[model samples]
Target: MNGNTERQFATNVYYDRTFDCDAAKILPGEFYYTGQDMLIVTVLGSCVAACIRDRVTGLGGMNHFMLPDGGDPASPVSASMRYGTFAMEVLINELLKAGARRENLEAKVFGGGAVLRGFTAMNVGERNAAFVMNYLKTEQIRVVAEDLNDIYPRKVYFFPRTGKVLVKKLMQTQNDTVAKRELDYASRLKVEPVAGEIDLF
Candidate 1:
């Protein structure tokens, strides 16, 4: 079936199911499922997730991106949606391709928190939040809701059928952040993420 049909099926079949923690199985950075009533979800940290929905039809899809750069030669499509610039383009394009009118498209963004310690919470969240909002404005897309710029992490839920997004501010005290920082530092030092063609951040 096409993406449109899949959306319809998702709306009709699983609208009332639980989508917490390991709910809908969206591939890394990319995910799609019939939510006829099910809540599709994805987790994020330094990354940002965009929830796009058709204003009229209510069909929607959410993508999680790690950096602003997707299509990074080193970052395959599997993880590219986790990037900022590419993720925005890809989600928007996919929405249009699925029969969503650009004029009728609504976007909701979440994440980009500096969850890791030692990292200047100096606003990576602000920058990512700004990047997505600015892109939406430039593209003429309407931003229906935005829960951003907080020091704490968030858990967001996107209801495709009605296009309602639920945001929960997860209180991650210093203790929570410090642990994440150590792990992030080790990964960052080990895996040097290559830059993509365009630096969207």
Candidate 2:
């Protein structure tokens, strides 16, 4: 709870009758966490989302991130882990502030697709997926579920309180929108770091 006592929510969402709770949609380079029962959603291409929760307290969060280009292998490893580290830490810290314990956190990860069709030689999808998994492992967080690496775009819906995640893989014809968004996001990272201050939970 920052200065704004009001809870932040997603806007312009079309209600889906399939789920009973209200939905909060997250876009590229954004993340959200809460103790409420509302659903958190996001569409993904090459970017990865780590859905983490404290099983006991039911406090959870999800972060969407793409690793920036690793220039100069000679640079310190910390420089390369910058964006990924920030994404992971923000989500985890928010959950902790909401009463989650570090030892009780479990994770579910999704989205790392090769949908861009060789746009970058570095294979960003693979790197993003690998980076998140390694980061979680290094932090001793157990990943309970994962849907990583493939050629399809996916829509993810996460229920923070219950730790339920529904993933729908889209057909090739329907992937254009997500691919373009993710590609644009990846391109933006090269020129500038993520804009704005990290949201205080």
Model-by-model lDDT, in order? 0.57, 0.78
Q: Write the per-residue lDDT of candidate 1 for residues 1-201, one digit (tens) a residue.
A: 121211121222233345432245332245463325547665556556778888787767786554433233233352422345555666666666677777777888887676654544344455567667776787777887877666667767777878877777777753365335434533442244433433321
Off by over 4 Å in 1: 1-28, 33-35, 68-82, 120-122, 173-201
Worst 10 residues of 2 by lDDT: 1-10
| Residue ranges of candidate 2 with Cα displaced over 4 Å | 1-15, 72-80, 194-201
lDDT of candidate 1? 0.57
Q: lDDT per residue, candidate 2, 69-169, as tens digits?
A: 66542333544456776778778877888799989999999998988877667677887798888889988999999999898888999998999999999
Q: Which pairs clash (backbone N, Cα, C closer than 3 Å) in model 2?
A: 1-201
Error of 1 at 183 (Å): 6.7
